[model samples]
Target: MLEHELVFALREIALLGGILGDVELSSSELGGILGISQQTASRRILELEEAGYIQRKPGVKKQLIHVTESGSERIKAEKEKYERIFEMGSRMRFSGTVISGMGEGRYYISQPGYTLHFRSALGFEPYPGTFNMQLNGAELNKLNILRNREGYTIPEFSTGDRTFGSVRFFRAEISGEPCGVVLPLRGHHKGVLEVIAGENMRQKLNLRDGDEARLTVFLDR
Candidate 1:
């Protein structure tokens, strides 16, 4: 479907609760919402239904419309693309002190399953450990916003009954070195940010426990 049609028709339907359940509305009502003619709205709805993006049941003056699973997926994919476009060239700053972790970073980063994706996505093999940072007040808020944005994702994998959670990484630079900000989907650290790089960040950046670290995260490649 055309981009504008998807944005104007399918997106509006989903927002009006069509994705969760059937929504009752007439072509005139949808046209009012879309600022288009009723004839156009009616045609768009028919097109959407024919494309398998929605199921429409006709009624006397209104119709029951429900967005299909395919429609939801299309909306989600479009949303992600828009998110990336919105964040392109944007920068987020982080100021925190180096901290100790529970030694889980090494174990998780060293796994071949995770490392393979890191190499492919981030353009380098990650070191076997993560550089942990204890984020401060404002930086923690920034991290929360970053979490909502789409980034490179390492999907969940399993090995011998053990399943690993997905991880998202944003391209970043720390002290003039290329790096990545890692956020594990199943992590418990609410105020901590883990950093990964091709080399040992602690030694390369000359960082120690309680030392201040600053990172600049770029939203795009």
Candidate 2:
């Protein structure tokens, strides 16, 4: 797969074509599977062919299409990506300086809408407050990628007159102790990371403002 999800999708289509004995496929069939219009499907196929990721069998009455070696390499690249992700899950690392938050985490986390999902998904009751950290330049970039990563999602729901937005959680270890990273679908700051655990992290970890802390985030939980 390429860096973009759309490109990966094209590669996946080609791989499927290769699997069915390089059989001919109609635009309608491809469009149906992709939930796209037949015209769009035809355009995608043309683009894939131009990129050398797929080819139409010459002189074939049925218009057979197959994945090229280049396309197979793209799938191989996707495999390598997952491999790296798993490897990172085992021991992925990130670090930042402990910082201060708006002091609202305690209120939001204490609510049932957030707490129930936290316990169900992360397997622990988060402490009343969240430990805030400021990521360095490189770590901030990593956090951006981690934001869209697969994890547990706490859906948005209404409580009383207000509705709360959904949030995502990833199992992690802060300074080698089990914890989690919480990210709201809408966030206030880009460089900040908020952590949750069963205990007050600042006290348990003996952390203070300006102290540098590292966390090992597990992608698969």
Candidate 3:
């Protein structure tokens, strides 16, 4: 992998944001941020334009540099690469507020307030307005901390449980009160589920396809 590609891509985009508005950059400012000489910065800008990462508006007096869609895609791809490296390990970082929980089930808010339901810890309150956030733990641990170590736990996993129409345990934030917590989802169809309860008892809370649900997983024993 190109170790410096991501870093360079970010720096290039940062420079483009400011330049997009203005006609051009003072050699000193660009060089200062890049820690290179003015000549070097100018050369790199030309190279970026040639590579299609940016556009140069032809003008007699001054040249204007702007970030292109390709540049934005490069930045996005780099971020995904870095994120995947961190996610596959036990070093998952959680950033969101715990909204609500009951009996040790916690739900976190990461998307807008409209979107809830996540794999989180248990134990929290109905934190409605603030951006209550907690980080520092493996992905699962970060979620569980919201339950505040309440009676939230997982049993062993089984092949039969992996099938449909069954009750199973998963760690997810249903409410923000307890940020990282466990909530149960009823498996009715494959990869589709219903929250254990709806507005009325004895009914299943069906979820939409592509909806996000956090699964609390345990080892098969």
Say which candidate scores most in TM-score: 2
Which sequence of candidate numbers ranks them by TM-score, best first?
2, 1, 3
How many Å off is the CA of 51 in candidate 1?
A: 68
Where model 3 places Cα greater than 4 Å from the true spot, the runs are: 1-12, 15-23, 58-62, 90-221
Write one digit per residue (lDDT tens) for candidate 2, span 32-132. 87787898777777878888877777435556777778877877777776786668745466789999889988988988988997787667778889998
- What is candidate 3's TM-score against the reference? 0.35
Candidate lDDT (C-alpha), each: 0.85, 0.78, 0.39
Residue 112 alpha-carbon offset, candidate 3, angstroms: 47
* lDDT value, residue 207 of candidate 1: 88
Give the clash count for each candidate.
Answer: 0, 1, 37
Q: Model 3, residue 116: what's the lDDT?
A: 25
TM-score of each: 0.58, 0.59, 0.35
Winner on lDDT (1 vs 2): 1
- Tens-digit per-residue lDDT, 13-98, candidate 3: 55567334434655455667778788876777767766676666755655666676776666667678688555533323243322
Rate residue 1 of model 3 by lDDT: 20
Q: Can you list the residue pairs that collide in candidate 1?
A: none
For residues 1-221, could you state the per-residue lDDT of candidate 1 as single tens digits? 47677556999999999989999989899999988899988888989888788998877768999999999988888887678656644877788999988899999888888888778867888988899899987768888777877788788899996998898888888988888888877756568988889899989988899999998787664
**Positional deviation of 143 in candidate 3, in angstroms?**
27
